[model samples]
Target: MCVVGIMVGLLLLFAAPGVGSLSLGFLFLLGAWFCLWFFPHDLAHHVVGRVLGVGFRYYFLGRSAITN
Candidate 1:
């Protein structure tokens, strides 16, 4: 999900300039910023978990982990 969010954020950022409307482009940029900001911490958690051999099934409310 973090990977997907990062990819979507990049896509939005790239597409923002071509949107042709200042307001719409700003919205896109904002969305990109949000996506870029939101997902990385969880990704880092996953990375550390993998390094420690701790597996997770999903997040609880996006912060708490539900491990498998």
Candidate 2:
């Protein structure tokens, strides 16, 4: 998933500048931003935390307890 996201992001980054329409290029840039943030960013955080012996816990935020 991460690899796919990155690939898509790279494609968008490259494709944006060459687009003939300004609105289309802007949309591509927004897509690239979302892809970059939504995929590899979280994976990277988890990887680093593991390497440093940090533990993580997930919890719900709606009328429930949250943990770290």
Candidate 3:
């Protein structure tokens, strides 16, 4: 997520007129989503799960909840 944010910021700063900053931003967001989709065991989800008192399992590729 942080990497995606930084990439988006850089793209916005350097994106050409024809390339469109909005499109670049969207692409960056998409990439972030992809990262999360592929690696859902990230700290963000873990933190949220812990805060919500949910049982969570972190896999190498993704995370899953055991119970609500």
Candidate 4:
């Protein structure tokens, strides 16, 4: 997911010749790219699971895993 986000960011930058000159905008774009990408990454798991007819008892990450 991180790799995908980074690749998209870099590609957008290089693809537009003058894009790198806008420093603040570039940073904001990267931030938004990662945030938006995360949603579909999590959703992909659920969609694929149902399509394959496999069930996950539960899923956890970060601090949630400790309590779970």
Select the stronger candidate by lDDT from 1 and 3: 1
lDDT of 2 by residue, 1-68 (tens): 77899899989989999999999999999999999877797679778999999998882335436577
User: Root-mean-square deviation of each candidate, in angstroms?
Assistant: 4.5, 4.1, 6.5, 6.6
Q: TM-score of predicted model 4? A: 0.48
lDDT by candidate, in order shown = 0.90, 0.86, 0.58, 0.64
Off-target runs (Cα >4 Å) in candidate 4 are 1-21, 63-68
Write the candidate numbers in order of decreasing lDDT.
Answer: 1, 2, 4, 3
Clashing pairs in 2: none
Q: Write the per-residue lDDT of candidate 4 for residues 14-52, one digit (tens) a residue.
A: 554455467766676666566556656767778888999
How much lDDT does candidate 2 score? 0.86
Q: Estimate each model's TM-score.
A: 0.73, 0.69, 0.31, 0.48
- Candidate 4: count the clashes: 0
Instruction: Give the per-residue lDDT of model 3 (tens digit) for 14-49.
Output: 443345477775776566555545444466667798
lDDT of 4 at 48: 88
lDDT of prediction 1: 0.90
List candidate 1 stretches off by more than 4 Å.
52-58, 62-68
Off by over 4 Å in 3: 1-20, 41-68
